[model samples]
Target chain A: MTEPHDLPSAAELVEAVREFLAHDVLPAVDGRVQFHTRVAVNVLGMVGRELALGPAQAAAHGEGLAALGVSSEAELARIIRQGGADDRMDDIGRFVRATVRAKLEVANPKYLAE
Target chain B: MSDGGRDAEPAALLRSVLDAPIENLRRLSGGASRETWSFDCGGRPLILRRDPPGAPKEGMAVEARLLRAAGACGVPVPEVVAAESSFIVMERVEGETIPRKILRDDAFAAARPALAAQCGTVLAALHRIPVEDFADLPDTDQVAEWRDILDSLGQPHPAFELGLRWLGENRPPRSGTTVVHGDFRNGNLIVGPEGVRAVLDWELAHRGDPLEDLGWLCVKAWRFGVNDKPVGGFGDYDELVGAYEDAGGGHVDRDALMWWQAMGTLKWGIMCIVQGSLHVSGTVRSVELAAIGRRVCENEWDLLDLLPYGRD
Candidate 1:
């Protein structure tokens, strides 16, 4: 293997475990077990997507914050709460929408599609 | 799904109250706060709503009174059988409360065409009830209340901040104060082929602006991913407004409703934070609540769409 952790990379391993639960365990279970198994599957799926997309998303998210001239999300939030951003509503709105989109990309991209 | 020998204490509570043998007691899923159990008592299908141990009992008693008040106003609601501080027994409502099923299932297709109007009519009827009659209901200044809640949660959600600012700045003058069904939405409705069978979940009922219920109903979360249909993914906004006005509700102001809608979306986003905090604080550990934390942005997306600042 090229790195310290051998072949089935972190993302690949999460996918393998998720698939095992979804395909092997989900079908055989019913009621509470079935529901929890599905949730577990979804959790892993989200983690896998984050591993694949998080780094680039972090970069894009920084750009989004820069568009609003805020150093951190908390600062942006405080400015809006205090009405300091009212004059620049259009710019702030654009930045908010883009960042929310990226967040859903990790959380649930289906939300963005709709 | 009869869970025999489980929930033994709750079953005993039912037996003592009804003085009849309880059978086929099984817990119903999907309620976030209250325990809902279905049981047969004296040849009647009843639902028992119990607060978790040590929780306040006054809420259940107040909810029972509100159900009767709404029913008196011709709103379809479950009939309360018996209500104590910690528990309430009501006639079990039989219909689907799941949004996706109510939106997609064939049985609801016919109901879908009429639900929006029915919802409007029902809300109008509900709003007609005298506010003074509900002496126990608390007044909620929602825009301010939710902001305080998000601030206390200490999580920075910028989208929520933007929407909250917009709502506060463009606050509409109060047209009327009425009985607002705070949690009225698609999922909280019991829908059948005929239409809405009963309105469930009155825990959030309060005294607020009459338009609040309508605005809350149209919140996109209740639409279940269907963006086109604005009113619960069932009927048009015109149908809802028309029916509401026709049913003795005052003139439906579009701008006021839109403002409330934006406010509703932000309130929901903050509520998601509160729910997630329950998990984070280890007060309640469940996958459902944890999953809701990530779902906050869904409402943020909807909130931004509602505000016309930067239309995408």
Candidate 2:
């Protein structure tokens, strides 16, 4: 199942770019530029994590929505807002928590760890 | 050349209004909606907080008056010297407002033990400010207000919706109305070795339930990655409530505090979406705002943490 194209995958490429910014570009800049660059590196790291985890997370969310008899997250959200799912709040909470945790895994794993 | 001296308009405006020569006028960072210029007026350090021209005029004047009123009541706040139509000249109390340093830095170590209670005391004083003095300030139902804002964003967030639904279902009895610091948190307070030196950022001041401030302070977002300590990552809930009581603040209901804390978490989650929308809509186009968009999950997770129905 391996279709070899490049040595560095997309995630590795992003990691290398983030490393360049953190190691090479960050120290060379100062003030606002440096600050924004650091933020950019963080964003890139998040991107890398998302690339690695997004597909599985999306599948899990889709399955969760399907389990609640909603085809999409929007439908699930509408049901929650209208109190249509009030009787199943425990189920809804578990679904929402799992979905949000998946997001935190990419956005900030340290948060989930804590 | 620095962006500080790029425009002489500020210096010229100061000279015209204050009748004094200005020196060392520089712009301080971090005001999304307003301009903050720090300068010396006749050898005295002062801050010029001004809204952009053609913007609404009354907010700054109202803020200046509010700071004055809060300070007069023994609340730690910068003194307002003079306020024009769109700006305020105030005595600048120097201190650090960065949340991370205030929570973790060695310099603030001595201040940590007393910081949360002090925050409670200061908030108590702020809540005691006379409401009749500022008749223009409106008392808003925060649950309704945040729900409306999230609705206007036109994005469906199930977690936020769940939180709002819970808040609507568990409406707390109104305890009484007072002046509420709409954004009372670590980032807004200036801290030094002693404790809170000055409470900055009065733009969000309004008359509402004082518990809103307490709940907002306890929001996990303000904890700055330190989730264990509930009161701004520096002190516990009992310490805060005890100090508030000792400082003559009214008694707060525990359930009400929990409800407001969940509401505050949902409010911040919705705000992250709104902030990200600004970037997506190509209005402001800021990386910082774009990055904040990702923080929506943090608030969502925190809301689940605070919500009572499903917590095991």
Candidate 3:
């Protein structure tokens, strides 16, 4: 079964739109619209990053939870909330730090260094 | 105030209050629930703060009184020239309200170093204001309030639940009640080269433990990326506590303050979700609010950092 339509990938298309907003649309606007355009561009960049990194990041998170003996993130969270992780905060800390870093990779990578 | 038709113009109603003609009555920035207008009367700039038209005016009424009470207690606030049930007419204080500018601007270099201490002193004064007259203000448990708010969102925020549980287990012994400026932080404080010029947005004012205000100031979310300085990204926690004590504030319990910081981070994260829900639920579609929703992860990261863990 040969599938037909192939040109710019979804990520590539998003990148193109992001560049257009940043280079062309951004400098052309001012005040509220300009501000919102910047946000829009940021949102696009986030979408692109998510498209690129989301699957692996999700898998890594699941593995991290599994390593903590929790089957899912929700279970890990519930167990932690219930103080079941109180004795093993070291593990929880490492897991949370790694998890948050992965999220920052998509949300705003600049903040990771900060 | 005249009990005129609901459709009556605000300008006309204000004209009766001000003897001189009003000019340049334009709407300033406000949220969906509130209205802020700037106008000039008798060659003086004035601000009109009111609830959105047709909404109940009770909160504005309390805020007007709070401003006056705060001023009386030596806390810097906009002077309320005239107040009615519907709106408050205050002398517009000119200053920078943006936190980033106050934190990073070389123009505010002189004021930056002193801000944390200044905040302590001002907050002490605000807390000393007698709360007996604010009977209408509701007293609610801060932790329970946030838990309810988060639960109401119907979102499974495991980090929030974890944070909430931590707070519940480590609940601090209640400090003495005081008039608290609930939203006391960088953005709410109008900063100038001299120092904090005035406090703005008293809508969140209430009676609570004075330390709640101190803890809220240290919330990593409010630090605006300058997390190195725990006190609004400008000064240290000990420095904030020292200044507060010097200004007649009660004792500082470091553990309690840290607990509140963790709680405040979760509180802010939950607030971001709520703001995003307004966009998600089609109540108020806003890109800005939706973007804030993405920042909740930042709070989660901060929570893990702040919580007592293996580092201890």
Candidate 4:
């Protein structure tokens, strides 16, 4: 089984699955299987993007909070878990501004994962 | 193999509608939580929106109700024909989803002011609609809401915590409560030669500070890679605000717009992270969704820069 990270681009992952289905699964299934292969293909494409980016984002977010004087990860976790209007702006707004600035500052030489 | 294979209940329900013929079904991308399809019915094009396989059951009615309200308010939205627990049928507007095409092409730049004007008019109109009609609407408490989402994700996200704190400390006083299209952005607006033909996607629509919509429109995420330009990645900030004001929105406070713009970036970043996690956990999987997740950090960084404290 290939790890999610090793799956290359979303297009490539989707193609690999299609090839597998055409060669292995299609032959075994009866005629008129009526699969919406296009939907599946699109879904996989979306999944590929998620796999490539999820961890890096989470990590960046953790780093951003620390920079903002958040004392501990646990506190931040608790805050997020409670999820209400704090006297503060919503988490969504803060993270976006911070992340965009970070990317602008350091286009991350190792950031080939897009 | 008639069109009844995938899910029997939905297909049967759809078939029951009068004059509903299965027109061509093509998946409309960009929604992680819902699956959207454009199909023709009885010679008229229509949209079918359904929850992705395992999405939560809440909010369907809210979306439908908001769309109805916006439609009543002269916002160019698809007409809601019918709605069920997991599915909604709507009139399909003829236009293209505003993408990099509008930004990259110089000809479209001329139409930016008009598009911005329409957006302002539509949004202001949406805000004017009486909120009393929607009885079960959620309150727009910033801190509490973020806290709840973080808890649901089941882990610590430092960026979120920091953002929450900053927002609380620098909370902008609400000017007035109005209907806010919680997710107004470039991709959500359908455009044509005339201008924005329709505003779609009401799932995140809510009642809150009207500036929230304005801020969302200017968010970097909606720019779709055109960082140099701000309004839907088409024109400058002044042009957008100018057009918005001309459309009877009155003078907008620059400070408030700035605050909301920053807020827009933060909100979108969190959503991207949540979607990314869903894909990672194998709950919901999509490459585009994951790619969006990767982009959240960039948005966060942008939000940081916008804040006074973020500057060196």
DockQ for each model = 0.70, 0.69, 0.54, 0.17
TM-score of 4: 0.69
Which rank order by TM-score, best down to worst? 2, 3, 1, 4
- TM-score of each predicted structure versus truth: 0.92, 0.94, 0.93, 0.69
Clashing pairs in model 1, backbone N/Cα/C closer than 3 A: none
Model 1 misplaced regions, further than 4 Å: A1-3, B1-8, B19-21, B30-32
Best-to-worst ranking by DockQ: 1, 2, 3, 4
The C-alpha RMSD of each candidate to the native structure, in angstroms, is 3.8, 3.6, 2.4, 8.7
Q: What lDDT does candidate 3 reach at residue A27?
A: 98
Best candidate per DockQ, number?
1
lDDT of 3 by residue, B238-310 (tens): 7889888899988889998888778778878888889889888988888887887787788887887776553
Candidate 4 per-residue lDDT over residues A16-88, each given as its tens digit: 8866766676666662342434334444544544465656866886786666446555665455435542434
Error of 3 at B260 (Å): 1.7
Q: What is the TM-score of chain A in candidate 2?
A: 0.90
Q: Which stretches of candidate 4 lie over 4 Å from their true place?
A: A1-114, B1-11, B20-22, B25-32, B52-58, B105-110, B151-160, B285-293
Cα lDDT of model 3 by residue, A5-71, tens digit: 4667788888999999999999999999899999989999999999999999999988888889988
Per-residue error (Å), model 2, residue B175:
1.7
Interface RMSD, in order shown: 1.3, 1.4, 2.3, 8.1
lDDT per residue as tens, model 2, B209-266: 8888899999998999877889999999998988998999999888888877887788
Evaluated on the second chain alone, the candidates' TM-scores are 0.92, 0.94, 0.95, 0.85
**For model 3, what is the alpha-carbon lDDT of residue B262?**
84
For all candidates in order, the CA lDDT equals: 0.85, 0.85, 0.83, 0.67
